[model samples]
Target: MKRPGIVLAHGKWDKPPYAIGTLADALRAAGHPVLTPELPWSLARLYDASFHDALLILDAAAQALRRQGCDRVVLGGHSMGANAAIACARRHASADGLLVLGPGHFPDWLHQQGISTDSLARAAHAVASGEQERLTLTDVFQGRPRPVRIPPAHYLEYFAADGPAVMPDNCRHLESLPLLWAVGRADAHFDLGRGYAYALAPPHPASAYHELEADHIGTPQAATALVLAWLARTFPEPA
Candidate 1:
């Protein structure tokens, strides 16, 4: 019996195919096929693509998994990658399951923190003025101020308060697929609790929320056992 294919996305400002390497390796060793895509928000690319473009990248990866003989596809991600996975599931509606670890990239929260407010305004102005040059924007990367250069139009798509990356809104639009949302106990976003976004997802018998003993970056590795158990239960091997 074939096991489900998994696409794991890396977090914002993190390197590709290695940021979530621990979890990806575990899943592969457990007999699941996994692909860790270098997302648009990765450290190397640094917002080279819009949030919508990131979804397109994920869509292509899912298709590749289907071509490789996977009977089912699951989308998993860490930090901003987790946020993107939720958006991808909402926009594509093709994934069979969702695994989110320490979901990050909340534009509204950023606005409240006063981190991207000025940059968002600048990006909006640049887009409105039809500027093509990339602008340096401030972002909270790993809990500190980091400067990222991105074209204004593309930046708006990611940092806009009501942009497509809003997890709660995205989770609300999810179909009947099962979800596994895991956050670290020491992670800052953990305080948001399930009510922040997990609770908004349509109820599914297999959906679950967990709190691990790790911080934001350490969540993927810490939740390995929990994730494996959940996968085995939710997607048993065919007889």
Candidate 2:
């Protein structure tokens, strides 16, 4: 097979348009063909029953990559997409690695599935207050990560499930892919403890976490650069 490429996935509230394209350009510059897809109605269904749709999107990406002769892929994502990428990588015949940048909503995702985060639960009143503009969110997102003003249907679709549902768990098999979990230490929406990455612990032993001195907004750029560097070292491009 040809040298593997990188597949980048984005999270809720963000469109897969220029955001992904721009990252693709950077990865291309790094010498790896990148596959970034427009997740199926993800922007609208993030809050709805879109988890199934999200899972399908991941499958479609893999199929698309395989058809393009990219069977060996390095799955990567920003925020929520990281979760999807992990699910996708684990479902297929395994991958080179899982690179997650600025993982978000992990606490809420887990909570929906009844995995309450005491840290977040401590802020229960605030969390349920429905505060449109939360200082905490601003602190984490920096540039103001608002509740994507999409249609109610779309919003409902977005959060279709209370998650951290362990997409890989469904198949009863974990992908032995290496993992590169990068997070901005300044990210307010991200608390490593709350991320509950413990589930990702042990097993393969080919994983590492790096803390960038940036918040959620700054993570994408920095994480992109880091991913490029790692992909070059791990899945080096054609000579």
Candidate 3:
């Protein structure tokens, strides 16, 4: 009769407040245990952040949830965090469900906009050469037109869609688990032809995808109702 716990991961350049705070609060108020662990890629030194590092954080959070009496825990994240959540769920045997919000596409939509990966490559080189611990980069995916700063090594981990943390590759791991894939219709990072299709075409019988009217950051509120309904259906409480 116990509800499944949830471990929500925040997106790149984001923390619990502007990221999973609202959703976590709502889920907790609804009686579901929730934990929004701070990802290394969030506020930590950029050079030390990597997809694998974020996965470790998720692992720790999941374990903490288990210690807190949650036998099952749903893995969820927003934006870049979604990709991390998927990667975590792929290898996590105890991940009961997956919730992907505004998931980023492989090769990214910016590639279609003619944005080259030269910057990323150069940053990687710099990191390899020990030239810099952090680098300022432009991301067409997240909000604000201003440039953002990140660690070159971490950038490669998440942005190199062809890399190990590729979203499509991760989604393919969703076979029988319950999945809720939600995205904002106005999200600049979402590529319908690629990302959306990949998520919708999952072979899992319990998988469902929704396109909401909100933007990248608005997904938490926009998909709240649907998320709750799905949770209820997927993990019903015994009478």
| TM-scores, one per candidate | 0.97, 0.68, 0.84
Off by over 4 Å in 1: none
Which residue segments of model 3 deviate by more than 4 Å?
A: 43-48, 105-116, 127-132, 143-146, 190-197, 200-202
| Candidate 3 colliding pairs, count | 0
Task: Score candidate 1 by TM-score against the native.
Answer: 0.97
Each prediction's whole-model lDDT (CA): 0.89, 0.57, 0.73
lDDT: the better of candidates 2 and 3: 3
State which candidate, 2 or 3, has the greater TM-score: 3
Q: Clash number for every model?
A: 0, 18, 0
Candidate 1 lDDT, 1-239, residue by residue in tens: 27899999889889745558999999999999898878888878888878898999988898899999997999989999999999999998759999999899888788878888999999989988989898888878656888878899988889788899888889889998889999999997778899999999999999999999999889999999999999999999888
Error of 1 at 8 (Å): 0.3
Error of 3 at 97 (Å): 0.6
Clashing pairs in 1: none
lDDT of each residue in 85-191, candidate 3, tens digit only: 88887766548888888875344544444453766677779877987566787554453433557677766776664665766666666556888888888887655
User: Least accurate stretch of 10 residues (summed lDDT) in model 3?
Assistant: 193-202
Name every residue pair that clashes in candidate 3.
none
